[model samples]
Structure formats: C-alpha cells, structure tokens
Target: MNGAGTKRRIGIGIVGCGGIAQSHAAALKRLEQAGECTVVGCADLVEEKAKGLAEKFELPSWYADARRLIDRPDVEAITVCTNPPFHVPATLMAAERGKHTIVEKPMTMDLAEADRAIEATRKANVRFGVIFMRRFWPGAQRARKAIDDGKLGDRLILGDCILKWTRRQAYYRDPWRGTWAGENGAALVNQAVHALDMFLWLMAPAGQLETVYGKWANLTHPYIEAEDNAVAALRWANGALGVLSVSISTDPQLGARITVTGDKGATVSVTEHPEGRFGLNDVWTIPGEEEEMGRLYERELQEGREHFKPFPIAHFWQLQDFLAAIREGRDPLVTGEEGRRSIELIEAIRLSTESGAEVKLPLRTSTWVPPTRR
Candidate 1:
C-alpha cells in the first residue's frame, strides 16, 4: 500500500550470511508473508553459510559467490551484509546489474571507497542506501523533529554520544572480528556507529562540523588488534561543541545514548538501554511538555517491546522504506550520501588520532590505513 500502487511484490536478494544477515532474513521473512516482498536468494563466501541461511528462510536459491546471486533475474534489490571490506564491492556488483542496494552501517572503511560506491550507484542510476535502522526508532524521529521545530531553541550548545558496551575476549575468536582489514575499527566503526550516525543526524540543524580531535587505544581485550575504546571532541560551524565516547570494555555495559542541549536551556536525550532495543526518550525538557516525559517513555517502551517481539521491527521498517522507494522512484531516507557523512566523521577521527592534530571537515581523499597491529 503506502503509495506502492498495487505493484507486484519486489524480489529481494541478500549478500553475506553472517549474524546480521540473519536479522535481515528474519525481517524479510515477515515482509514475504505480508506480500510486500519475496526473498529470491542469498549468498556467502562459505557454502555452508549460504546454504544454511537459504534453508532456514526457505529462500529460492543460494550461491557461494555474491555475483551469482546478484545475477538472478528476479532480484530487484539486494542488501549487503558482508564485512566492511566487501561492502563497496558487493554494492558495485548490485549497481552494475541495476539492482537497488542497501548496505550495513559504516558504509565503507574510508571516504574514498565511500565516494566510489556513491559514484557507481549514481552513474548506474540505481537507488543506494545504508542501514542506519535505529534512525527509524520512534524516539530518534521525535528528537529530530524537536530540533527542526525549534523546541530546543535556535542555537544548539552541546551534543553528546555515549556507547559503553561489553564484548568478551571470546567474541574475537573469529579471525576477522577485530582486524582493521576485517571489521574495520572496532568500537567506533562497528558498535558505536549507530549512535554516532544518530548524533550526526540530530545535530545537522546546528550546521556543519568544523574540526575533530580524537584518541583511541586497546584499553582491554588484548586479544584483539583494534581499539576497544575511543573518544573524540568536535566543533561545528555554528560554534556548537560535541563529544563522542565509546568503549567495548565496560564490564556491565552501560548501553548507548545521545543527548543535546540548546541555548533555550532545554535538553533532550534518546537512549537504547541493553542495546538492540528500540530507543526511548529518556530525557525531555521542552517547556510545557516536561510532565509528559515519563508517560511518553513508558508508552513507547511497551510499544517497542510488543513490536520487536515479532522481529527486529527497525530493520523491517527500513527495508520497507527501501522497497517503497524503489516502487515510488524516490530515494530511501538513508541514502549513500547520508551514510557517507558518518564514515567521513569516523575517518576524521582516525586521521586526528594518527596526526595528533585536529582534522577538518570535508576531508581530502587519501590512501591512509590504520597501522597494523598483532
């Protein structure tokens, strides 16, 4: 419905059958049942993984090579759930075939690959999107609206993003888990990326960011090569200051949250406690609406619980948007360009860490890579 205009169900294909791919498959299963889309096939470098996902979801086909799955005549769109290294390549494959593509977060390891992915999709004239599913959360939407509506006042004073979560040493048993070439940077690029994207999106009204200075270290998890903790300070063109603190070493895991304060002396926050759950407005102080905070939070928390009981509704909602965009000939909410912004921020942080100097916005293209660690 939703302006889809009675068209046939879109055929969907998936690349990379990892843990995240399972979530996508489960979400696609629901869409298939609703007659909105059908899972045509799935693929992974490991034959067993590809076969297992296909058998689990009862998808029509499975392939050991992503290109084979992308070649399927029925698949009109594909979701790339591969490792960071494969994201751009798989997107290029899908774009070459005129298939719409939606990639997982941290669009690419660096800005150059991000630009290439954007250009390829643009030149091919196909829709390209990144999976920032949390953006669909009710609280995140509300926070954005508050800023846009001036409820938080004219000039934003501060933006804070905090993500403190635990990952046991065993979690890195997989050879690729913490490697720069495999998962990219650990805490900031993989775990904290969702919150960081939300922070950037919420602060868009504050004008462009001017500079970033960052520090990172493998404070714990000696078994891994990537940083387990990182922090960055940022300044925006509008003179707003921001801080990002992320770590995978917290023992009890504090979860993820983003808070913003405006010159109106009002502050608001959206939090995802225990992680992976729907976010709720944990803090709201918008003049007359102060009293409604508790009620609104409780209501949304219960709704999120009920909605997510079926499947990860955030992924479902975002996938629905991608499919609807295809049907309506419009761009998905998280376009390749929108996704590129988060990667740019991550890159700036890394550059700052290496150079021990503040990095400026709209970073110039470079072949810089993180130093190898064992």
Candidate 2:
C-alpha cells in the first residue's frame, strides 16, 4: 500500500484536529475507498479531539502526541495540521523518520521555520509538498498559460491584488483566532497567503521580488494581537510590481478572491473554493486575440464541468500528485522551497511594516522558533 494506505498499504497519520482537519479527513475517506490511501492513525494535543476525528473518519487509532503517532511502524506518511508555531517540529520530526509530508500553508508564519521545513524534507529525501491547492484552479492554470504565451503583451507583473473579504468579530470570536503568536499575523499570512500564492503562480519565470513596503494597522479589532487588515507593495526583479490588500474585519465575510492586471489585458479574478463546482474558473480578455482566447476558454469551461464533480474531493488532485511524485521519486507541483517563498515574502512584508523599509527577496531567516506551547 502507498501513502494513502492500502494497495500500496501505505500507513497515514494526521497531526491536528482543528477545523481544517475535517476537510482533510473527508478527503482521506474518499481516497481510501478508492484504494488510493488508508489512515493508520491520527494525533492531536488533545487525545479525545484526535480520537473524535479518527472515529468520525473511522481511522484505526489516534494519539495525543504527533511524535508517538509518527513513530508508529505502520505510518509511511503524515499531514501536519497543527497551528503556526508547532508546524516546524511536527513536519521536521515526521521527515526525520523518513516519511512523506503534506504541510499546511504559510508553513509557518516566519521565514526561519519555513526554511527549516524545506531543508528537512530535502535532506530526508521524502516527498514534500505545500498545500497551496489554488494551483489546481482551472481558471488559474488557464490564466497562467495565457500569461506565459505572452497573450498579455509585455505584461508588467500585476498592478494590484484586491482581496476585499468580510469577517465580523464573530469570526475572530475565538481568542486564538487573531493573536500574533497564535495565528501569526492577520490578513497577510492568514487570508492573503492564498491570494499571494495565486499572485506568484501567475507571475512565475519572472525574477523574485526584490522589495516590499507594507502599511498595516489594528483597524477594527484592537483586542487582537495582529492587524485585522494590511496592504503590501511588491516589486519584482523585472521592475514589474504589484499590490496586495486584505482585511478580516469587513462585513459579510466575502469568500477568498484575487484580481490580477497586466499591460495588454486582464483576468478579473481567481478563487480557490475546493468544495465549489468550478474548482477554478477564469474570465479573460486577450488584447489582439480575444476571439481565439474566448473560444478556448469556452471549451475549457465545458470540460471543467465534466471533470470537477461536486464532492469533498478537492485535495484528491494535490494528493494524487504527491503520491505520484513519491512513487516516481520527484518533486510534486508545489515543492517545499516553492511553498516557503510565500512565507518569506510575507515575513518581508511584516518586517517592512515593522521596520519601515522595503526588504529584499532571498531574505535571511533568523530568530527561528521551534514548536512549543506558550
């Protein structure tokens, strides 16, 4: 069995029981029945919480500590779903045991932790992938291809990524929801990470961003340790630049979204709603090739409907790629290093906000924190 558990009997372990864990379990459930995987066990700080998830998903066992679970002889792979601070250790520990890993985004809220995760996976020679599942977006891929083909014409990176979402006090009602140490920073890391990934994915092959200037404030929720909203200006090496905006205190809690612009034309938006019908969709206006682009897009749209069936099957694509990479011994779509870039950039934005200067890319990672409870 393989990483998903059966036919290849790859043992699987989960290390967190937070809200996102449910989605992970559901996806695992479907994967297992299809003979793509099996869940040997799951773990969390709270044993019963992990027990509950295992029971719901019908996993064979559960543990209070991830280390114990990873140490299990049966486990061949692990999913680290713990909060920001604990992500590094959980991931590194599993990798050290020579097991494959699937880490949640912003891997950690800081560059140092992210770097460590990247290096550990590389050194361990295991299949490591980041969960920026937005890459699976149908429209995102379409937009990326158009950009690569120069359909946008001498395009400057992107002018701005306007992410206007609404979240009320209730969303942050849980104290852990908005703390610097707990959730890391607010809008940029938590909310904008998805947007930022899509931002960079479309702008690939361009030089890494060299400078970042950010302005942030507590905004509506002063009780929280992190900013409720933030905006950062990004300068790519090619002199092309972009701006990002995020807020968690807005009204109505609008779903996550991104809008990109170029010199020739624009694709108004990109969103990642794994449960949604259109895993990815795009609306674009190619400068001199509108007719051809539209026709192609229409065909893609029709095909997308047939492929993205309604179910909690979003991660199947990402998980399949990881499994294939593990089987083939290669890097998956989002490598550990590629995954860490977003965190590095986010850190630069945070630092720029704190230091009042534009930080450069390939930024140094210092003041690293190992996973530990406050």
Candidate 3:
C-alpha cells in the first residue's frame, strides 16, 4: 500500500543467511503479507543456511552461491547481509543484474569500496538503501523533529554517546566476525555503528567533523584481531564537541544511549534498550519542553510497538520505505551516499588511533583498512 499498489508486487531475494538475515526475512514476510512484495528466493555461501532460511521464510528457491540468486529472473531486488568485505562485491553483482539492493550497515570495508558500490548502483539505475533502522525508531524521529523545529536552538554544544552491549567470546568464534579483515573493525564499526549513526543524525547541521582521536584495545577476546572497546572524541565544524564510546565487554549490557546538549539550554537523550528491554525508550527529555515532547514520544513509541510486535518495527518501516523508493523512482531513506557518513567517521577514528594524532575533516586518504593488530 505504501508503494505503487498491491497488484504490482516487487520480486525480492536475499543473500547471506546470517544472524541479521532473520530480521530481513521477517520484514520481507510482513511486507509480502501486506502485498507489496514477494520473497522469491535466497542464497548463502553455506548451502544449509540458504536452505534453512528459504524454508523458514517460505521462499521458493535457495542457492549455495549468491550469483545464482542474483541471476534469478524472479528476484528483482535483494538484501545483502554478508560480512563487511562481501557487501560491495555482492551489491555490485546485484546491480549488474539490474536488481535494487538493500545493504546491511557499515556499507563496506572502507570508503573506496563504498564509492565503488555507489557508482555501480548509479550506473545500473537501481535503488540502493542501507539498513540504518534506528532512523525509523519513534524516539529518534521525535528527536529529529525537535531539533529541526529549533527546539535545540541554533548550535549543538555537546553530544555524548555510549554503546555498552555485551557479546560473549563464543559470539566472535565465527571466523568472519571480530576480525579486522572480516568485519572491517570491531565495536565502533560493528556494534556501535547504530549509535554512531544516531549521534551523527541528531548532531546534523553541525556539518563536517574537524578532528577525531581515539584508542582501541582488545581487553577481552584476545583470539580476535579486533578491539573489544574504543573511545573517540570529535569536533564539528559548527563548534560542537562530541565523545563516543563503544564496548562489547559490558558485563550486563547497558544498551545504547546518546545525550545531546544545545547552547540554548535544551537537551535531548535517547536510550535504545534499557536493561535489555526491546524497543523501549528509557530516557527522552527536553529541559523546558519536557511535558509536551515526552507525551509525543510516548504516544509514537506505543503506536510503533502496537503496530509491529515480536519483530522490530523499525525494520518493517525501513523495508516499506525501500519498496516505496523503488516504486516512486527515488532514493530510499538511507541511500548509499548518506550511509557513507558513519563509515567516514569510523575511518577517522581508526586513523586517529593509528597515527596517535587528531585526524582532520574530509579525510585525506581512503586506503586505511581496519587495523589488523589485536
């Protein structure tokens, strides 16, 4: 209903049947039920994963190789859920086959690959979207609205974000995760990326970042070649300063949070998952306009929860936006170019850590891969 019409359902497929694939599968099923699309097939390097996902989502076919799925005439679009390195390659494959693509976050290993992927989609004339689902969250939407309405005044002064989620050593046992080459980076790029994106979105109008410096360490999980914790401080061109901290070593998983302060004495904060409660906004406050903003956020959060239960509502909304973008011949909510911001920020953090000096705005080089040292 959000797109052209229920009668002209878009054909869809998925590649990479990993943990995140479940979310994509469920979202597709919901959209299919709404008659906006059809789940035509799926593919994975592991044949069993593909078969299992196909059966779980009731897809018509499964393939051991993604090329097969891309080649399928019935699959007009695809969701790429592979590792960081495979993102660009798989996306380009789908683009070459004239398929709209929705990629899971981090876009790719580095900016060079991101540029290539964006160019591929542009040349192919297909819709390209990144799954920064937090953008669709009710609290985030309200926060953005408040900022846009001048509630936060002209300039932001401070923004602090922390992602203290826990992942067991066993979780990184997967060969492709928690590795510099495989995941591109650890906490900052992998898990904390959501919070980073949220911070960037909320701190907008604060344009280009002036400097970034950070340090990362493998306090736990020494077997992995990536840091389990990292901290970065940033300065915006608009004179705003922000600090971002991410760690997978939080004992009880504190969840993600961002607190922003503006020069006009207005502040807004969003808590993603307080104490492991899914879809719950633990903190949302605006000094003078607390009552009105609080009530509005509460209402929207409740509505979103009621509309999308069991599965993440944000994912459903993002999928709908993707389909609608394709039908309307427009860019989706999080286009490839827009998605590059978070990656660019992450790379700045990496550069600062490696050089032990503050990295400047409009990063000079795109060649830095995720650090390989543990």
In model 2, which range of ten residues has the least summed lDDT?
A: 365-374
True-structure RMSD, every candidate:
1.8, 4.2, 2.6
Instruction: Give the candidate order by descending lDDT.
Output: 1, 3, 2
For residues 133-239, write the lDDT of model 1, one tens digit per residue. Answer: 99999899999999999999998989999998888877776688888878777887888889889999999888998899998889888888788898999999899
lDDT against the true structure, each candidate: 0.88, 0.72, 0.82
| Candidate 1 C-alpha error for residue 146, in Å | 0.9
Q: Which 10-residue span in candidate 1 carries the lowest summed lDDT?
A: 365-374
Root mean square deviation (Cα) for candidate 3: 2.6
lDDT of 2 by residue, 145-248 (tens): 76777766676556566555655566676666667667776766776777778777776645677888887777887666677778888888777878887776
Residue 368 displacement in candidate 2 (angstroms): 11
Per-residue lDDT of 232-331 in model 3, one digit per residue for the tens? 9999998999999888988564778887878786778777654333333445455666677667657766665556557866788998899888887899
What's model 1's lDDT at 73? Answer: 89
Decide which is better by lDDT, 2 or 3.
3
Please give the distance, in angstroms, between residue 49's alpha carbon in candidate 1 and its true position after superposition: 0.9
Q: What TM-score against the true fold does each predicted structure earn?
A: 0.96, 0.86, 0.92
Model 3 poorest ten-residue lDDT run = 274-283
